[model samples]
Target: MRRTSARSRISRALAVATAVAAVAGLTAYQGVAAEPAARTLAAGSPEGYGAGTTGGAGGPTVTVTSADAFIDAAASDGPLQIQVNGTIQLDDMEKVTSNKTIVGTGTRGRITGGGLNVSKASNVIIQNLTFSGSDDDAINVQYSTRVWIDHNDISDAYDGACDVKRASDGVTVSWNHFHDQDKNALLGHSDDNGSEDRGKLHVSYHHNWFDATTQRNPRVRFGNPVHVYNNYYYNNSGYGVASTEEAGVLVEGNYFENVKDPYHLGEADSGPGSLVARNNQLVNSGSGQTGGSVSTPSYSYRLDPAANVKSIVTSGSGVGHV
Candidate 1:
């Protein structure tokens, strides 16, 4: 299906709302329908955006406490503030529009049972939410730009906990926790769909806690120059980072504990990507395979020692009080 523009979608939604109000002889509802939300958010900065990206600015704040309300708010156009005050369990994927800030109010505000899909959206921020038992990916970013997924607890998904593909760029996935899950994260899905994902899928993953995930801490495919740093991996039953499809992955400053296979350039050297591993600390883990070099990250961020990564991540990563 052809993607509809956010403005056009909003216009249609407002028109429907107005028509409904008119049919009900409630004209006053039109005056206060889907107004611009007001929000103060730091812009997203990745891939040449110096200070990061901005999202859903100058809009009204909508506090959603149920699945239907959350879906309604997410369907609306951006510059929107969506505050989740409690759990919103869904039966399907919720499409999030452009320029949106979806944050949890506290530790208990979470999205469970279903998931969120951000496709063809720009300037989105998702933070401080716990997602589990989702029928699909906990959070999927496809063909999106300037997205930040931070401080969320994602696990037990039917698919990947967090998956980024389909030419998504300018993204940062940081400070999250993944435990007791398989197919933890995937940068690119299909090896044949390289036209849309070959030069894109630029993402920075840092300070995430991968605990007991069976595999694919992040299975990379055709995502060149993926910056993965300062993450804590513990008791991983499967390999940590697999760089396949000629992707250049810079895996650095991470702590791997009791992980059999930490990092590899490709699956048994079958693919063509390269990996650069340096200054990392490993305990009871296989030495990661490294061959190729990747480009450095765009912005400068503080990274603690590999020895301190486990402690810092265990103490700070995941939902609640982030």
Candidate 2:
């Protein structure tokens, strides 16, 4: 993927924010179900406090209208707060951003077509937005660092719900609700640019809930080492987590229910570097049992000892679990 300069990335973010604002009339718009107290949030109170600086906190609130305005605002020198009211559609959202924060009216603040595409930007935060019914991913990042996505509900995405792709580094995806998403909940990497033939790396996904009716949770691909922990998932068509062709992964303490397939670690590089699974709880609720593939690590690279799990409660395991 082509890398965007810092200036251009910020510019694109602001531009989009501006256009979205105008279409939604969020500048003075009030939520139809907004509570009276929620309208006037106290300035210094935690409820309605402004977003901060690029690295700090405290920034101006801008509404999204046109894509250009959104890009420009997100690239501003300081932190930015984006309030999404209506649908923000994009012809192409390959824009990168730095040090901006976006919020929406829960899941109702719809950004339908344009994904919050970020690559190689740093210190960006997105919170409280619902990315709904998009033909593409709700939000995607490539080569970005220090980005946080919190409490945003993304679903019905044509591809992955959120992809930390192409070696994007230092991203945290947490507390978001997801359902009916295809592909993975979070797809990430760990190592550096291995070969130009492959892709860049660096990303982490944690604490997100996935209610997949058709697909699975996530796959650590292209040696992208990611940390998966404490998340809940159900009715996935695939594994809870798998290292498809990548390595340096850690899966710990996650809860799974009615997952059609539990875990699979194949097609990864021969070395132990490509896969690691431990301390994850996978239970099939229906009559179908949990089905997966597991092998002892090669003695050369077996670092962490895999734990034998005792079935907790009358858990299902690919055996009539369905």
Candidate 3:
């Protein structure tokens, strides 16, 4: 039993009507700081840092200055804290696998003319960096799992900014800034080829800010079952979030300052099935929608009542449990 928002409201009504329960908790999505985890992949490599074994147990606190040497010498174990005193070129293809952490030197330091391509990797973390004048995706994830991308600024990507593809699962993107891209700042794919079908795929986006000055393209492509939360989108020349086909989706707790919606649901297909939306603050945005599906928000808590709810639920509520 999946309970829709209507059922949740009805349950509240019934409880009020019969006085069976008092004050059903307001169903709201909280923000997960994901900040500490944002710093490094983990603490120490209790298991030792290597490419095969889950990379490092945590992130290494190592610091580097050059992008050329950092990519060549970086290991999957621990955080690779590199400071870019000057501009670095990323023309060489780099492979990040297992749980590796890559943090840029200064936010002002820029990575130009290279692609941070993720291929067949898992548990990868990249943040606090900037990419400009990249011919391809500044960041790309393929056949990966458990990826966390936050707090980076990307722009002027001739192709796209970020792309998630090839049956990737358990991805969380938050607190990033985007500008001047040809496609979504965040994109997902259930299957890269037509042969593979969607069996299990889950992704989440939170607390991102987007500003598009040109009419290049939109900000998000929702290709899989995704959860979009608490983001601030503005000056988008295109859609905020859209889907190529039907997907299980949830859009909630977002603050849209100025946007244009080609579809009310931000999708080309009728829309995704089992879609849930609530508490989304939209201002000066279009309300065009498409598709057919059941979408609502804040109903999971109402369907099954539980005690000590905090343990079972974790979000951006000043706590970090991912």
Candidate 4:
């Protein structure tokens, strides 16, 4: 059941804050520190296909508060960690190059009006940012590899909050709060691009809070073993995860509340795919459709119990919470 009381929510938030403060020498997201830490994947590192993603680690950290400065830093050459300190209003979809870590500072970092384009790049990280009013996708990854997107709050984008397509591989989208948006995350752009996307587009979607989002809590295609696990879904108007165009998805250990259509094998104009659902907890939600055999994820990671997913995700997802 959903914890609707304000007192309960405050207690949970306070408990989470206390736990974060106990971790020593980690980063701002974990505890208070004199200097910001370098870019690193939190805790157990990225699981599933993005297991080895390490973005902009061992690089000089540069803080950017203006749009021009952020854009310049994002497109600069070599490995760099760009720390966003305030709202950066962008004019268009800004291009980000390889070996970059773009992270928000505390809860003040915000990206508005435009979005990020990770095109043909590799080893990039985007974390702890608030993305809204995007003219395009809040984060678009195309032809990229080994990218990790974590701990972001995304909403109000004209296009998808995050869209990964065009043969991107080894990507992880985790611990994000996606709400107040129509289209959410998507994988594999087109039905005709199977030639380029047949063996690619492998992604992991885990531990995210899909709160009242309409649809596409990723509508996927051509990604085998797309791992969707330990996520919390609440009051989504449209369906949750869609595995279309012969993709294979594993929906496991999730907590779904008031989502009528949770997971399915196909979407509009797309043929049936393969899906496996296991150990999911549904409250006032339908038992999602499933069929065919899905390849097991090769990476090893611990799974949080489905009963605790609401508290776990709500406490840890979005900016400033890491």
TM-score top scorer = 4
Off by over 4 Å in 2: 1-56, 65-72, 75-78, 94-96, 186-193, 196-202, 222-225, 267-274, 285-322
Candidate 3 whole-model C-alpha lDDT, 0 to 1: 0.50
lDDT by residue (1-322, candidate 1, tens digit) is: 2124333444554455434532432111211233233334322333332126666555554556666667766878646766677888889888998988888877876898899999999888888888999998899989898888888898899998999988898888888899969989998868777888888888888889999998888888887788888999999987899888978888889999999899986664447587898889999999988887787766777777999999999999988746
Could you give candidate 3's per-residue lDDT for residues 84-158 as a string of tens digits? 334667774466756566655544446788767767777566666777888777877777776766667778877
Per-model lDDT:
0.78, 0.51, 0.50, 0.84
| TM-score of each model, paired residue for residue | 0.85, 0.64, 0.65, 0.87
Q: What TM-score does candidate 3 get on C-alpha atoms?
A: 0.65
User: How far in Å is the alpha carbon of 275 misplaced in model 1?
Assistant: 0.4
- Between prediction 1 and prediction 2, which has the larger TM-score? 1
lDDT of 4: 0.84
Ranking by TM-score: 4, 1, 3, 2
List where candidate 1 sits over 4 angstroms from the true fold: 1-51, 268-270
Off by over 4 Å in 3: 1-60, 74-86, 106-109, 189-197, 213-224, 262-275, 290-322
Best lDDT goes to which candidate? Answer: 4
| Reference-based lDDT, residue 51, model 2 | 19
**Candidate 3: worst 10 consecutive residues by lDDT?**
28-37
